[model samples]
Target: MKFYKRTETRKINIGGVIIGGGAPVAIQSMTNTNSRDWKATVRQIKQLEETGCEIVRISLPDMGSACNLGKIKKNIKIPLVADVHFDYRIALEAIKQGADKLRINPGNIGSKDKISILAKEAKKAHIPIRIGVNAGSLKKVHNFSDNFLRAKVLSSAAMEHVKILEKHSFQDIVVSLKASNIDITVKAYKIFASKRNYPLHLGITEAGSIFSGTIKSAAGLGIILYDGIGDTIRISLTANPVEEVKTAYSLLQSMELRNSGIEIVSCPTCSRCEVDLIKIVAEVEKKTSAIKNLKRLPKPVKVALMGCIINGPGEAKDADFGIAGGKNTGILFKNGRLIGNVNVDKWVEKIISMIKDYCR
Candidate 1:
């Protein structure tokens, strides 16, 4: 398959992970837990790390939260980014407290002196700053009558904020133009890519709950990533933040941009389906996910769980391990060839065993 020609942008290191300049697109998620609640936030961040989140952001709504950054940083393995707004002092405190990166709109920080201070402090800490410009927060995002025009407006706003940092000789920067509307968000990124060589942080701002947000993020981020425009991605969802990281990786996998983890391609059951395909698939996914973030596997093992005999065998044949149902029994297969039949009750255990063997 032909891959999208990725745009070459300046690479910025967020902690140890690199973004842009043709590097692998990093996955990011924000902690929803109260930042001041050190234990809970650290717990959530650890969970995100297990799920393959490379960069994590936490809100610095007050000085108390900002002050706790050092403690949180000591507990987390991946890069910790602080999300601050309106106040440059909190941004300054976040840097001194050991934030690996900062997410702040330079334009909203009051004055050029404040922005200069933030830039100098962040550079001294060897941390990059992300100029997050959301369409909802743009000065004229809604003032424009046309949707497409609003996208241009969004892009323009981000560039203007970017210039403030550039004026301070701060080039260690990443930018994002996010909107809940996928089309507008995509357009804005495209426009910005044409004008700048800064690494981009991609996401649909406030992308709804798990169910709907996944679909929207996949569509919008998929399109933008396909254009080879994004350097890092965060699948924003109102649900548990872990879902965000999982969904980001899934999107990258779907685009064949990533080959990490076990990718189970199962069929949606039809009238011909007689077995409990949903339950079996869910169990297999849950059990096998433990090996996902590890480097133990030589490669991702494709497991197909088909509901019926006709399409099941054909589809399962392609997977490293798969099963097709027939009456009360299902035919187990290895690499497209049938091995044997098993009771439906044993399906989950059998798949789990195959996975363990493969990982070994």
Candidate 2:
């Protein structure tokens, strides 16, 4: 349950949020909005913050987008990181605009002098830089002649960039070695962690649509985190970035790494189900999602929605509150003990009301 003792790494502050060094693993998501539109980016970021995203990354594809960091940073509560590639100037402009962190590859930025200049500026600003190495782009630096060398190649390329920053005496650094393939992603991070203690940003890149991507991310991130190899995570999906945050929280929650919202323990409808359990669960989710963002709540609440006796109360016996569906009726219970039976139509509302009062 302790997840391999949470490997200790150097602590670095992205804005005011501390990551690594035994801190709680932070959830991060990137904004898909065009960065030049500061207002739009701010809007999306606020949604991310509301959904419990602690760090937000936005792309700085050009100077114009880089210039908008100050404006966007002013409107969001979470720390902002600029994702920069190929251009050291955009990285500089992002820093000057008050970006909390920079994700850049020193190797890809240019010559030694350019990297040194950027590192010096970042050092003066007291900000951290992430050496992001992707499997797709790393081929330029190393030969991919053998599949067995992929993980080592990825880790080595990242260290090569880290050396560039270290040469300039810049130590505030984070690193990510991501590949679309889960096995490769996990191996890359494991190999890197074995070699150094820098904080790692984890994800299965280009991880498809929400349904498929969630499964892929969970499998990859689950194993990596179980090994205590990640300090932060971004569950990349092709859907809305908010979905990314939600999926990240779900993954973290399952790993017992984060406990932020109500945990639903519902059994999939079976042949024994005698009521419209699907509709009831959907309604419960919709209603809870609304109250989940309320300013005040004692703590996370777990509610079970069961359809039959086979695994209903027995399986979810620890649920704070729950209902087992029946023919036009429901059995309300608390911690597996029978409270009473009620009309199925009122089960959702009654459970929510009781939870609201208990939380108060």
Candidate 3:
């Protein structure tokens, strides 16, 4: 039921997780914990992994943090990506410590000879390198007056780095072209994909707080992904990294591109609404958050929670299961048929029970 044709690209494995080459778009998040504190980093990574994060990146600011890569990798189930900058030596150290992939900006990672050295070492380890180019970090294109021109400049910068790695006979690469602005980010990715078949990682860099960041990322990423351009994605929110993973899966699910976890289709209330819809929806979400590995379900268990009967019956019938509220009672339905009514107080408990049964 995939609606869009994916752009074929070279497949690259991050540890055992694959991206591109018609593989499912991988979800990634970065740990905000200090890498040198290997214990804390491991704890955060484990949390992300349990929340369905397939790959995790951690900052390697110095040799101290680079030395902890093995410790972090050993404790986590997902692939570990090392974020290194300025020094090529840190990149080499990260490789030595068994980083599944390396993220670097060649523009600031020293000279061509140093990059060649790092490239050779990474080749030896059979690990991929991500050339992450952020608009804020780009040395060129200070004026972003015209988004198309900015996108061209951004794509050029990423190509320059790609060529450097290619020159060294290193082709295991992933590329990310990111900007805070949706227009520039979408345009750059479209431009880059048309030029190379390398796997592209998508994101809106420095996207703000959870509320706004989710909207901005969805709007921007939706455009690029719907066009069938990106291979992997991260919704970079200023909030906890776990939220980032949740947001990523939700976005993919909305497009019917992925099926994992609970897909709640609820309505915004109005005067016609008789029940406390806001409170009910919040309670449902909070309770369901404890349901781990819903991804194991054959598909997302579609759940609809509506505040009024006007459109409630239709929406409830449309979902795998749902509750259409009226007064203090709700009409529960499953697979388009009535399942009898339940008190408002029992909605959360009933939905949780039905979901577990549905999954089983």
Each prediction's TM-score against the native? 0.96, 0.95, 0.97
**Order of models, best lDDT first:** 3, 1, 2
lDDT of 3 by residue, 1-360 (tens): 779888999999999999999998999999999999999999999999888999999999999999999998988899999999898889899999999999998557778788788789999999999999888877676776899999998999899889999999999999999999999999999999999999999999999999999999999999999999888999999999999999999999998877767899898888988889899889988888888768888778999998887788785676898898899999988888887998999998899999888878
> How well does candidate 1 match the true structure in TM-score terms?
0.96
lDDT: which candidate is best? 3
lDDT of 1 by residue, 21-113 (tens): 888889999999999999899999999999888999999999999999999999989999999988889999998888999998744766767
lDDT of 2: 0.86
How much lDDT does candidate 1 score? 0.87
Q: Which stretches of candidate 1 lie over 4 Å from their true place?
A: 292-298
Model 3 alpha-carbon drift over 4 Å, by segment: none
* Candidate 1 local lDDT, residue 191: 94
> TM-score rank, highest first?
3, 1, 2
Q: Among these predicted structures, which one has the highest TM-score?
A: 3
**How much lDDT does each candidate structure score?**
0.87, 0.86, 0.91
Kindly list the per-residue Cα lDDT of model 2 for residues 39-155, writing each as its tens digit. Answer: 999999999988888999999999999999999999988999999988889999999999999998644667778878888999999999998888877654246654447877888
Stretches of candidate 2 exceeding 4 Å from the true structure: 1-3, 140-147, 292-299
